[model samples]
Target: MKDMIPVDRKMSTMQDSKISARGVQVYYGETHAIKDVSVEIADNTVTAFIGPSGCGKSTFLRCINRMNDTIDTARVMGDILIDGEDIYDPRVDPVQLRAKVGMVFQKPNPFPKSIYDNVAYGPKIHGLARNKADLDEIVEKSLRKAALWEEAKDRLDKPGTGLSGGQQQRLCIARAIATAPEVLLMDEPCSALDPIATAQVEELIDELRQSYSVVIVTHSMQQAARVSQKTAFFHLGNLVEYDDTDKIFTNPQDPRTESYISGRIG
Candidate 1:
């Protein structure tokens, strides 16, 4: 059985965080999607957010990169700091912010352009490379980091959409990393992939944490256990519990977390 403990008690037990959220909330028109949630994402580690359908896990993830701003009715409040700087400040340009904090969605959305073009897009837009050779170097480096270079090195001119679902996802990851983002947000990245593809992506995610902070919203408890160093359990717009992944899976501190993880309730 899981213990019943206060949320603060659980958080106090973790190490320092790289990105911190305090009293964060989100609303879509009249619907309160997220309510007063606070948590920390450690640097160079993978953190997983798990919950049932409509539980605000994805909503909270979008807040980190300011993706919610694209929604007409979406509204976010409270503090979300990356490296101790409040991202919600009026001075923050979401365009520039998104460059520093990249996101990958549930589907493997690759552009219609060639694979090389896909990886070079961010660097081209951000002016990270000066000449053609520099841009090619950046693309090659990004693909190598994403582990897609061997498969894609010869097919650089092939359309990104021509790849398999799993390959496309990896390509998207390469595209995100091409910008050298400090943080990476993934929302159900494997939900659309097959078992083998899922495994490959999961392995890649683990490798990614050595250089970038990763936050993932996943529906599979086993996936979370396999990938994340930390886990946050959300229920009904509230963050019920957050702790080491091992503890959350083996011995959750909240009844709600226990119930959800134990298949008793969502």
Candidate 2:
């Protein structure tokens, strides 16, 4: 395992949480997915959600951006606040909320459009750019942030699908950041990548914490230790424990968390 570097050392000052969830609950038709979960995610920090395969980590993650609204049978009940404003309010627009909170899925799902267009899509839809020149700059900057500009710059007009798996994943990340989102949610982003590709994405995730509040749901305990400053361990639809990465991994308070971390139970 690589030595984990502290992200706080790279920042001049600590920022307050960008997201706060209180009594969050989720249901999929008759199944209760998340049970009264609450957590506060700080700005410019990386928070990892970890647990067994069927735990509610992913379900609760979708609540942060209101992504569950797309499912007819999915229901969310809670007060999720971004910047102190309730995102679950009836007046809040899910489309606009998604724009503010970007997501990168488990698999690399880049659009069939050109590399430039894939990154430009979000900015265009959100009106982040005023004209062609502005859009070009946003696209370039986004790709650069995702650490794909050097490889993708010459292939701006090429199909996004033509890129390598890692490149395509980075492109998807570029697409997400293009909207200038304040918070970024990653659902097992490294799950589909090779070790080399996963390392690159992990590095990018650390770098991203300098600007955005990053929340990641990953099954790899090593990954959770490597990428996150804070860690939340979920079990059977319940948030069993949440604390500093070092404490959670080294000195967990909950017996369930200790069992999961020690590989005794999951």
Candidate 3:
């Protein structure tokens, strides 16, 4: 596999990053969620954010695409740059930014629309396809990328919600990638799947790293070790450690990380 290379070496070799966060912090009303966290995410790599519940892992993930801005009580302070451009700049439209940075949630939240329409939603809204043929081609390509085209081909008009849990998640993945995003964010994507389906999604995640930067928030340490090149551990809203996944799991430098990994404390 392409990921066979040493992760530390891979990180050192790729000088360009898809996203950079500097002193990023998020607040929900009186609660300070993320605190002074900063990291660089390389392109075409999978980075996992692992932590116990409510440790700000998911909150920080949302900041990448400015998904946190939707909450009236949420306030983000700090610099988040995508390809050297500050995404929180006044001129950058959150809607347009989301197209470039696609996200899949913990659940398979496919639209109430048909399978075809679900995948085509982003492309249609972004005007990515010029006509019906173009739209069809894009929809096919996205479904194929998500590894769901063959199963759904005969039932394109069926409701996306009608698919099995795993299929629905893949459909959501298709919908996210239809716009051809530069970065893909996933929050506990495999949490709802069975072992077989989880394996499928994990394989798909590895394949996706070839085309886009993938950042995932997962509670499972094993999942982070399996699917991510880099892993960041968060504790009490602070970024405790960030390094190659192997290093983070095998030789974590911080005591907090070690404790968390050793099952001493969450």
lDDT of 2 by residue, 1-266 (tens): 23453445343255777898999989999999999999988898899999998899999999999889999999998899999999999999999999999999999999999999999999988888989999999999999999999999999999999999999999999999999999999999989999999999999998999889999999989999888889999999999999888778878999999889778886
Stretches of candidate 1 exceeding 4 Å from the true structure: 1-15
Clashing pairs in 2: none
Predicted structure with the largest lDDT when compared to the true one: 3
Worst 10 residues of 2 by lDDT: 1-10
Error of 2 at 57 (Å): 0.4
Q: Which lDDT tens digits does candidate 3 get at residues 1-266?
A: 22443454344346588899999989999999999999999988899999889999999999999999999999999999999999999999999999999999999999999999999999999999999999999999999999999999999999999999999999999999999999999999999999899989999998998899999999888788888889999999999999988888888999999999878887
For model 3, the local distance difference test gives: 0.93
Score residue 217 of candidate 3 by CA lDDT. Answer: 95
Residue 202, candidate 1: how far off, in angstroms? 0.7
Give the clashing pairs for model 3: none
Local distance difference test, each candidate: 0.91, 0.91, 0.93
- Give all TM-scores, in the order shown: 0.94, 0.96, 0.95
Error of 2 at 199 (Å): 0.6
